[model samples]
Target: MADTLQAGDAAPDFKLPRDGEGFLTLADFKGKKLVLYFYPKDDTSGCTAEAIAFNGLTGDFAAAGTAIVGASPDPVKKHDKFRQKYELSFPLLADESKQMLEAYGVWVEKSMYGRKYMGVERTTFLIGADGRVARTWRKVKVPGHAEEVLAAARQL
Candidate 1:
């Protein structure tokens, strides 16, 4: 895996398809803090819950000048459906080629039921306005995660 990013490290740049048929890049969030989260799938239980949690706090995040974005291997079509189903307010980035995932070191070998496979590690990064990573949370637990991220973003 590429060296995992840490606080003080420059956030990697990316241009990815979003749910509504446009691209999102780090530069798009220039001059604003960002909450970038990576999940393994679009409609799974944990993913859904996390998306909803973030959506519920969209106003709070905006108040803090932080933009929330979610990225998954799913295509834009699936992302659209998921967002509509949950009424998600933030953009869901489609990283179909897994390029951004690898760059962020969120793609990893995961084990479940004694089987090992490659998947997203359920990670979140809080990037400050200057494009440096402010904090990172790996192996994220869905419950109350958005709240935790918000707390961290507020500090930034």
Candidate 2:
């Protein structure tokens, strides 16, 4: 397990494959505020809603000079499908090895139906232009979460 990052700490750097074309590195986002979100899976109900809500607010995020990036343990193919299905404007990173998820402290043991399994926990990190965590939402509730992230991005 990786150490949990706290607000005001430097966001961890990662390089992961995007849904299309090529890979994206944290360095590429320098000089811009970033909304880095981690979700459990692709095309699931809550995940779908969260992605769509973010997609719906892409313009607002752009107006604030912020970029959004979603990450999951799913493969690049899955990300491609999810992006295409939702018309998401941002890149969905493929973290097949779960390294990035663990680094972000979003990968953990989760319980459902009396069974526990390791998975990505819903979380979001608002990274400032300076590359530090400006805000963080852990165990996030998907409903209205994108709007809350937008508000934080605006403040950044």
Candidate 3:
């Protein structure tokens, strides 16, 4: 596996299908900060809360010139339903092949109840306008995370 990315590393490039029937890529946010969050699945409690929190802060994030996007290995159909169910304000990219998740170093072996398996780690990357990572949160705890990322973007 590649070493975990740090604040100064160049963010990996990705182009994936999104919930809104369009594709988004790293270059799309070239001149703005981006919050790229990777989660395990859609509609789960933690994931739902995280999405809603970010959705609620769309205006605040836009004011800071930041864009928010979520990603998961779930298919595009799943993403669409999850977004519509929660009325999510941002796009959720479907990484069915797990390439983007692996490139970001979030796809890994996980242990649950003493059993090990591979899954997506809850992680978030704050990519600066220069295409370098400005911050990263690994093993993320959802509460107040969106606000924290927003604060950082405002600082940027």
Of the candidates shown, which would achieve the greatest lDDT relative to the real structure? 1
Clashing pairs in 2: none
Give the per-residue lDDT digits (tens) of candidate 3, residues 1-156. Answer: 334789999999999999969899999999999999999999999999999999999999999999999999999999999999999989999998989998999999999899999999999999999999999999999999989999999998
Per-residue CA lDDT of candidate 1, range 52-135, in tens? 999999999999999999999999999999999999989999998999999999989999999999999999999999999999
User: Which is better, 1 or 2, measured by lDDT?
Assistant: 1
lDDT of 2 at 10: 89
Clashing pairs in 1: none
Q: Mark the regions of model 2 whose C-alpha exceeds 4 Å error after superposition.
A: 1-3
Q: Tens digits of per-residue lDDT for model 2 on 4-92? A: 69888989899999999699998999999999999999999999999999999999999999999999998999999989988889999
User: Would you estimate the TM-scores of all the predictions?
Assistant: 0.97, 0.97, 0.97
lDDT for model 3, please.
Answer: 0.93
Local error of candidate 2 at residue 144 (angstroms): 0.9
Off by over 4 Å in 3: none
Candidate 2 has its poorest 10 consecutive residues by lDDT at 1-10
